[model samples]
Structures are given as C-alpha cells and as structure tokens.
Target: MNVHETEVRARALGLLRSGSKNADVARELSVPVGTIGYWKHLDRAKRGECPGRHDPKCPRCDGRGLDEPAYSYLLGLYLGDGHISHYSAHRVPNLMVTCGESWPGLLDECELAMRTVFPDNSVCQVRRTGCRNVKVYSKHLECLFPQHGPGKKHERAIVLEPWQQAIVDAHPWEFIRGLIHSDGCRITNWTTRLVAGERKRYEYPRYFFSNKSDDIRKLFTDALDSVGVEWTTLARGSDPFNISVARKASVALMDTHVGPKH
Candidate 1:
C-alpha cells in the first residue's frame, strides 16, 4: 500500500527483519529514515508489540538517590496545599500545588522543588483565578508521596513513613518554610503603649499557620519544636485550627529563615 515499488518495499522489509538499523537501511534504499521507522513500527504493532513501554528515572522503582531537602520541602507543600491526580496505571499522574499569584517567588520555588525532585520529568504552571497551579507529571509520584489517597487529606489519616520523617527531622526549617509558604502567613500587629509620658505605638510580628487537619498542624508544630521555635495553638470557636509563633525568640528565628511571603 505504500508509494514505493513492491520490490523496494520487500527489500526494505527484508533489511529491517535482518536487524539493519533504520538509518542504514534508508541510506542503502535511498529512502527517508522516518519511512523505515514507520514500517518497523507497523510491523511491530501487527506482531502485537506494545507501544511506549519504557522506564523513566524514579527513585523508588529505579533505586536512584533523592534530593532529601527538596523532597522534605515538597512533602510539606504537598501536605499543605498539593494533590496528585491518578487517572490510570497506563498514564502518568500529575502533582499540583496551588500558589497565590501575589507571591511569584513562592511559585518559582515550588516549581524548582518539583523539578529537583523529578529531574527527568516536566513541570508546568496552570493559571487559575488569583492563583497558579504548579504541576509536575511523573509515573512515580505516588511512590514519592505516600500520603496521597481518597477524600480530603484532613478527612484521612495523614502520617509520614519513617524515611520521610527522617528527612523532615534533618531539614526541619525547609519543611516549615514550605508549610508557611502554603497555608501560613507572617503579619505585624501594633498597639499603643505608654513609654515616656506620651502614648507610643509599638509593632510586633508573628507567624500563623491555619489548617483544618489536626495531623498537619501537629506535623508543623513538631517541626517547629525540633528547630527550637516556640508555637501555640489558637482556637476559633471550639476548633483549634491555628498555630501561632509570637514569642520574641521564635519570631526572630522565623524572620531570619521563613520571613513574610513575597
């Protein structure tokens, strides 16, 4: 059915079947290499060969090393404001983290962490109303993020594997930074104080992280504790959903490392 003469087609097929590379066969037959590849692909398909089955670089499946600090930060972001979509086993899943448009720097950092974690895959940004969904496509996303599951993260039990915990234990500040960048904020509060016979205004800065999940809050606070940053729980009505870091020393530590999101 191809345009070439029947004899030429038979010769090409014969050369291909004899283990000749497409480029060599094309040079010998005076044909485009792509045509030779196409013929080979068709031949394979007719013989029941599956298409596009290959291994990508994956830490868990391929026994490759991971960037632990980046993984720790990405894990915090995933726990705070990210999700993985799995359509089927034959297709790769997408990992997405929502970042506010106001903080372009945070978006860049999020994308960088994703790229560092999955160096062989592609990372992209999808714009939404007032936010951007920074995403990466990888076949091994679930292997990296075991916290992925059904329903909302808060509804399900969110626990880290031992290896993940060890990484968090080593890079606690990066983990806290990722969480703060996602669901926390650094703000200033001011009040009038009597200092010299006249009322003077004084300002103090603090960091606050709010999440509906008790386990997530505990994880954040635990990381803070590991790094010697003091934190307290603030209750809104009956639900204690806020973690506040207002102590002078703790605020200084946070300011030095995870300052206000830009």
Candidate 2:
C-alpha cells in the first residue's frame, strides 16, 4: 500500500479499536466494511493467531465488488425510508464511481453519515431490480431525447425530484418532518388543542409507539435553533411541548402536537 493507503488503513484500525461499528468505519473511510474483516484476518495471521478456515477466493478479495458501496451511498440519501429504482444506467454509473469503495469502510461511512444526517432510522432498501449492465447515455443525448426511443433495450431511467434531494441534504430530523408532513395526514384537533393557550405541553404515544419521533423532534429543534429561532418548553400534565419561532423567520411554528386522533 502507498503512504495514503497506509494512513487510511491505520485510521480505520483506530476507529475500529474505538468501538466504531465496522460498517460505519468503512463508510467514513470510503472502503468496504468487509475489508475490515479481511484486515482482522490479516492481523491475526501476522500475530500467528488462527481463525477457522475461511474461503480463499472471496468475491470481495477477488475484486468482484459487492452492492454495499452503492447501498451505502443510497442509504446516505434515504436514511432508510426512501425508494430506489435501478433503471438509470447513466445515473448509476456516476453514483458507483462516487461511492465506490471497499465494502467495510463504505458501509461504515454510509451508516455514520445516516446517523449524523438522519438518526431516527437506518436506510432501508425498499426495492431493487436485478443486476444488469446499463448503458450510460451522453448528456447531449439525454437532453435531446428525453424519452426512450423504441430501440432501447434497457429499463427506463429513474428520476429523483428536488424534494427528494432536499430530504437527502437535510438532517435526519428535518427529513423525517418532511416525510411526515408530505404524507398529508391531517393534524388532530386534540393535538392542536394543547397549543391553544398555556397547555403547550403534549405527550407522545407510548415509547414503542413513538419510536423515532422524539429523536426527530430534538433534531428539528436543533435545526431551528441554528437559525436563531427562539424556543421554550412547556409542561402539560406529564407531557412536554416545544414552542419555537424564527427571528425574522417566516415559517409558522405549528402549535399542534403530532398524534393520532380518533
């Protein structure tokens, strides 16, 4: 390995010793998480440690890349709640190049980025198509012929919207809030009632019921605060409520607590 490669490996080992998840370390280091496993194996060998017999021609070592890198990159965008349709060869090539790394580090970095960007949940692969070679069309061709011609054999290209990109760019809390609001679920009158007067506090459902909600709420508040939004907490019964608004901020603070209404 070159000097840079050695440095990266050393940093990775340090991260592993620090109890960082292998997948997280991989992503941060832009390597495959499985590479960590290989490193461990190598380490054991160097120390005359014996691990059980393992496959010699593992796909990763053989240079046959795994889907982890691509998965990790997408995970950074989705945070475990978005859809991925693999029909765009042009787009996929760029993504692969950008995210290309060994599985261990790639997976680790992807997960870490997800946690930092969206701590509420891990990125989930909702859908995936078969692994097939896709043709990357030139930009000029794409612009000139936006639609697929009759002779095209490949699947249709997938288009991601600006809102989707926004979710990818925002922190986890912001992403979750956007998802929730985008669902178009009507706010409950009861939840809104808490914000009407001094009863600003509200409790979420059971811990299990709210799952990722609390984390998301905290994240949103942090984002709000960064923008100079003044906020205060109120107590209503046992529940806690947050009241915040931006200074010279146009976005209205929703006074309503989010909950299911019967």
Candidate 3:
C-alpha cells in the first residue's frame, strides 16, 4: 500500500485501541469510516480468533459472522455524500443496525439521519436528463456563497460534462474573452426560479461577464424575458452572475448597444 494508506490504516488501528469509535476515527482521518471495521476484521483473522462458521461472539463483530451491518450502514452514508451534520454522526449507526428491511429502509434511515444532522438545513431533489437516462440527485444549498470564504475562491460546484462544456466553449467570446478576465471560468449549479412552474432553470455562478455598463442589468433581463425565460437579478456589484445564458444574453445585448463592427 502507499504511504498515505498505510498511515491511515495504522492510525485507524491506534484509534480502535484507544477506545475511539469507528465514526470518530473516520472523520478524524478523512477516510471512509467503514474502513475501521475492515482493519478490525483483519486483526481478528490474524489472531486466529475468527470462526469457520456462524461465529456469534466476536467482540469486534469480525469473527462473529454477524453482517458487520455497521460497515454497510456507514458506507452508504459516505457514498451518498459525506456532508452529514456533525451532531447526527453519534446516533445514526445505532438506528441503522437496529432497523430492519432493505434498500428502502436504508434510505429512510439516511433521511432520518440527515434531518437529525442538519435540523435547519433544507433539502431539494433535482432531476436532469443524461444520455443514458433521466437521473436525479439531491442537493442542499447552505446559503449564497460567502463573499470571503476561504479556499479556491469558488464554492463546491458540479463540473460540466463534455457536451455542456462544448456549448459553453462555443460561446467563448462571452465566457472566456468577455465575462472572466482570468485564465478560465467555472460553471456552477446554482439555480434560481424567476416564477413557479417554469420548465427551464437558470444557473448562476458567483461571477459574470464584463462590468461595463449601468444598464446591462435591464438589458439582460429584457433579453431573457424576450426568450420567455424569467430571471432574478442578484446584487453582485460589478461581478456578473456566472451563468451560460446570462453570458450569451449579455453578449447579444452588448452587440446591440455597440452595433456591428463597421
């Protein structure tokens, strides 16, 4: 194994010896919490304490032939997105092990865990069309990206796929040459609904195109309305909302205002 993985394993073993819970070890190490159970099983096997069939008394749940349900429960949460609330971590495991049923039960267990973890947080499900099928993902927006948050300047966002990237690149005059003066721009998944029941959604990154004119806001708003898409204006001072349509609309608006090159 690599140095990092070795160190993580050693640290996990140490945490177990120190009476630390698996969840604590996982969070502290930033590794999937389920790994602690795996190491413990390995240790039990090395000691020859594991059984040949249906062992039921292993203290670490390794040789007991029990399902090590804790590992599966924790794995699901980690795979779903390790953004659980700090408070919920302590109680979620117990509930999962005790709860019967299968996949749906697991989902219900997670939903309960999420509610307990983020009492005030709001959750929303977004559906999108993919090449293979329509897929749905759950997302939670904590709030507008903080103006002065640390790390990378931009918030955690979904990366665009190749086709989406192509559409974005085709409008390079607006995205690359116009909106951002930096080396490149990023697309975010933040959406705002101008009116209820609108079929199309609008994405707004934290930045926008050029900051040239005062009437740019109205111009863009009018353009979106002209195309039958409603929009909400965010007061971001000189920064334009980092959205594809906004970039496209802004380019069109600027062209109209400045007129075609003679």
Candidate 4:
C-alpha cells in the first residue's frame, strides 16, 4: 500500500475502535462505509479470526495484466460512479459501487458485476439512506482498477495505463454498457408531430452520460466512437456536462449491447 492508504486505514480503524459507526467513519473519511467494513474484515483475518479471500501466491497478483470481461465492464462503472479503496489494513482491495435504491435493477446489475469480477468472494449489499452499496473483497481488483486514488475523480487526472487502454480497446461495448448503466441512462423522448393531418406523439429512445472530468468524458466518447455509436453533446450550464445518443439506429445498437440497467 501507499502512504495515503496507510493513513486512511489507520484513521478508519482508530475511529471505529472509538465507538464510531461505520457510516460515520466513512463520512469523516469521504469514503464508502463498505471500505471501513473491509478494514474490519482485514483486522479479523490478520489475527487468524477470518479466512479472507487472499492468497499471496495467487498468479493473478503475479504482476500480469488482468484483461477480462468483468474488469472491462467494471472499468466503465468505476469511471462513471464506482469507487475503489486500497486500505493498508486490508489484504486486498475494497470496491464500492452504488446506485439509487429506487432502481433495484441497477443495484442488481452492480451486484452481478461484482460477483462476476470476484467469484471467490462474497459481495455484500448495505442499505444506506437513499442508495444501495455493493462491496467486493479481492486482491486482483487493484490491478484492473488502478485509478484508485484520493479526492473526487473530477478533481484530478483520470488517465488509463497502456494495459488498461488495451483491454478497453478490446471490449469497447462492454465499457460503454457499464458507463451508460452507471452515469448514463436510457430514456424515451417524445415529441408531437404531424403524422396524419392533425398531430401524433413520436417516442424515441436515447442514451446519455454526464460527467465533470474532461478526461472521463473523453474516455466515454472515445469508447463510443470506437464502437460506431454516434452521440451529441447536450448543452448544460454547469461544471459536469452531458452527452447523448438519440438517433434511431444508435439507440437500437445500444439496446442490443447495453439495454436498460434494470
């Protein structure tokens, strides 16, 4: 682990031992509660209390690329709305991705993605105030999600290494699906038109993604461009901007590849 991770893990553990709730600790640290929970599991495993999903001799952690389908899909989610925390107190990485509680389907998809990425680990979901949290414990996760760092994604650079770029180039659609499912959404846009002599409601579907980081926005659009998915920039007078694909064929293509998150 690094110095920042070491400091955060220490703070989390200390705060927890001092009668602080996991949520409170997370709030104080600007991290997800699942992150503190991962530290808790690590504290147990270190004392021979819990058998964690950790193996020092695992080949996946032998400094090789983990270019897999699950990782590709997860990359999109991470860039969109996921957060990966590397704690020195834990033996592996803790990844937390949440969606609104109202969208159980999205929550289910996030859980499924986590399970697929870490089949040997148990994915846990915690009910928060307005969102559902999905946490996964796996050592190999850090390899695939090297973007794990401090502050918000928009506040710093979000560049991918050469290895990660190669994986994304190989699975562009999966990346797009994850991004759309997380930060973007599919919706129907209706407009009144003259079908007969009077008027008719024409409904069309579209996919949109909004992010503050220019790098993230570029990454998302580049992935779409690679897949021949045409999208346009939507005007928004804010820091984080939105881009969308509303053409008929493009929507169908996204539907076939990504579909609705639920």
Of the candidates shown, which would achieve the greatest lDDT relative to the real structure?
Answer: 1
What are the per-residue Cα lDDT tens digits for candidate 1 across 12-66? 8899889998779989999755456556655654665423234467787788889
- Quote the lDDT for 14 in model 3: 81
Give the residue spans of candidate 2 off by over 4 A: 1-212, 241-262
Q: Model 2 misses residue 49 by how many Å?
A: 46
List ranges where model 1 is wrong by over 4 Å.
1-53, 87-90
lDDT by residue (1-262, candidate 3, tens digit) is 8999998898888887788876688788887433455565455446653322232232222332322232223222332222323223121111111211223333344434433432332222111232111111112211111111223223322333353234333332322221222211334556666576765677643323322233333333333444333344444565654233335554455444321212
- What are the per-residue Cα lDDT tens digits for candidate 2 across 1-262? 8999899988987886677876798789898554664554345445554232232222222443223333223332332222223344212211111222222343344344433322222221111132111111112222211222333212333333443334334433343333232221222222434454656644332111111234334544554455344545434565553333322231233223222211
Candidate 3 regions with alpha-carbon error over 4 angstroms: 51-262
TM-score of each: 0.78, 0.21, 0.24, 0.74
lDDT of 4 by residue, 60-91 (tens): 46654243676788788878888987667656
Candidates' lDDT values, in order?
0.85, 0.35, 0.35, 0.78
In model 3, the clashing pairs are 55-64, 179-209, 205-242, 207-240, 207-242, 208-240
The top-ranked prediction according to TM-score is 1
Candidate 1 clashes: the total is 0
User: Number of clashing residue pairs in every model?
Assistant: 0, 25, 6, 0
Which ten residues in a row are the worst by lDDT in model 2?
131-140
Pitting candidate 2 against candidate 4, the one with the higher TM-score is 4
